[model samples]
Target: MEAFAVPGLPEFETGDDIATAIEAACDLRGDDVLCVASTIVSKVEGRTATLADYPAGPRAREIAARFEEQTGEERDPRFAQAVLEESTDLVMDEPFLLTETRFGHVGVNAGIDRSNTGGAELLLLPKRPSESARRIRERLSVDASVVVTDTSGRPFRHGQTGVAIGWAGMPASRDWRGETDRDGHELEVTVESVVDELAATANLVSGEGDDGTPAVVVRDWTFGDHEGSENLYRSVEGDFVRQALREWHYEQ
Candidate 1:
């Protein structure tokens, strides 16, 4: 499997045709998987907010005060307000707020990003990432798959890695149920998140800072037909970490 970036993309803006830009930047082939950063997708979809757009509300100020008091790290209330507005539920408030986004994604600050925006602007995750990927795939001339990716920190893990937020035209997970192992042992509960793996691999080529290459084309791999990254999400009831945290919060 080989992955390379589609370079020479100009700074994206609201209403820009991202599919056209991607096509212009790279020569796409059938069966290729395109991994695109969520920042560009948010930019094109007009999912950006400025300080002026999200003024600090009373709740924002309260949350900001609590955050600063706990972490001793000062943060802007307006930014906190923006994060709250983008989130469907707030799981934690101190250190960093772990929020469930409107799209059902649970992460820090509801995936409200401040980096890579010019100035005083915040980028939110795409309203519907799967739809965005599907649209981009339909617009491109070649038959290919698309995965919308974002940088995220994992629990009990240091540093950050790329994760698939949305995808189209390929199975997000490859279930190996009823298969055999090296010794012909029956395999169960061995589903692999191929989309996230591709996203993480593609990020190796699409650097986080100033690289200007937000999209990468991965070739030389075969994929089965599927849709979206919904299979990747764990329900709150079934998530041990979240359930434990909820119990701890209640006890506190």
Candidate 2:
């Protein structure tokens, strides 16, 4: 499969037609998978905000003070408040704020991005990324799949890679369980995230800085004959790492 960014896109703004802008920039085929950076998605969805919007309360001030005490770098209490407002649970409160967004995605600062924020002080993630993808998919003229992507630092990795936060018109994973390998060993638990793969491919061309290409079209990739699953995020009850983090947080 080949992926290329849609060129000549203007800096998007609130209420900009993402489907129209993409269709104007490139001719997408029905079989293609369209990957969109969450930046542009947040832009069109009007998720911009400023530090003034979130007044720092006692909890936010405490969190910021603790972070400052540990890192020796002062953090804005308003920023902490913004993170808290966007999150349903705070996974970590020291050194950095690791929190779970209301929509179930977990990330630092509840995914309230400051870089490339379309000139806003903060660019919040889409309220519901999956629904955002679905809306974009429905507006498209072709029968293409859509994946909303974000740059995410992996647990044990040094740098960040693209991860799918929202997807439409396709299952999240290609289930490989019970399938036979070359040596005839049945696959017990192998699920491939096609959306994340596509997102990474798109990011390869999308670039991190000033490329201005936030949307990419991936062509000629097929899921093949395989079972699909939509289970991606894990609940707190079953997520050992999250539980461990919580335990550590309380222990501190």
Candidate 3:
């Protein structure tokens, strides 16, 4: 697979479409997956809030509230967004994982950032990345996949790596249960996330380092038709309220 880093992208603004940039970077006939960082999408959508404009505490509170409203669940009331990268369980100076947001998006800074942006403009995750990807695919009129990526922290890791929080035109999870390997050994339940792998590969070129690039197109790969991230969410029956009760009762 070949990855090409797209350079010379300007500070994106609200309503600034990426159709042209994406088209120029793509090889519509060849097999390729366009991996875009959430930060650039956020910039294009103008998803920033000025910390200087509003008082820090108030701004943070408002952001937290908005996150809760968007995610339909309670989050850390004091959580603040920033720009930072993470390493992995065995490697230092490696950007292999992404952080998870309260909304279950795993990417860098929980898909938030402040660096390389306009004054006081903090970047956020795309409002609807899967939808965005679908739209881009339609615009290009090609047989390519799109992935919106972010950084995430692992279970036993001290740092973070990249992951696909949103994907279109690709299967984030491939179920290999009951299937056979080369030796006809029944694959005892192995689910692979191709989207995350694509994102990590793209990140190799579009690093947080001084590459000055935020997007990449990965060529030569076979992927499934586009689904979405909506179904990926785990169903929350009634656990949240119970957890709240546990905390409240303990306090009492």
Error of 1 at 26 (Å): 1.5
Ranking by lDDT: 2, 1, 3
Q: lDDT score, residue 58, model 3?
A: 59
Model 1 misplaced regions, further than 4 Å: 224-230, 249-252
Model 1, clash count? 0
Error of 1 at 5 (Å): 0.4
| TM-score list, all predictions | 0.93, 0.97, 0.69
Q: 67-132, model 1: which lDDT tens digit per residue?
A: 777778888898899889888777776567888887677889889888986453788899989899
Per-residue lDDT of 1-252 in model 2, one digit per residue for the tens?
888889899999999989988998899889999999999999999999999999999999998898877778889999999999999999988778889988788898888899898899999999999999999999999999999999887677799888899999999999998899888999876999888888889889898898898999999999889999998788999999999988785333
What lDDT, from 0 to 1, does candidate 3 have?
Answer: 0.60
- List the candidate 2 regions with Cα displacement exceeding 4 Å: 249-252
Q: State residue 195's C-alpha deviation in candidate 2, in Å.
A: 1.3
- Ordered from best to worst TM-score, the candidate numbers read 2, 1, 3
* Candidate 1 vs. true structure, TM-score: 0.93
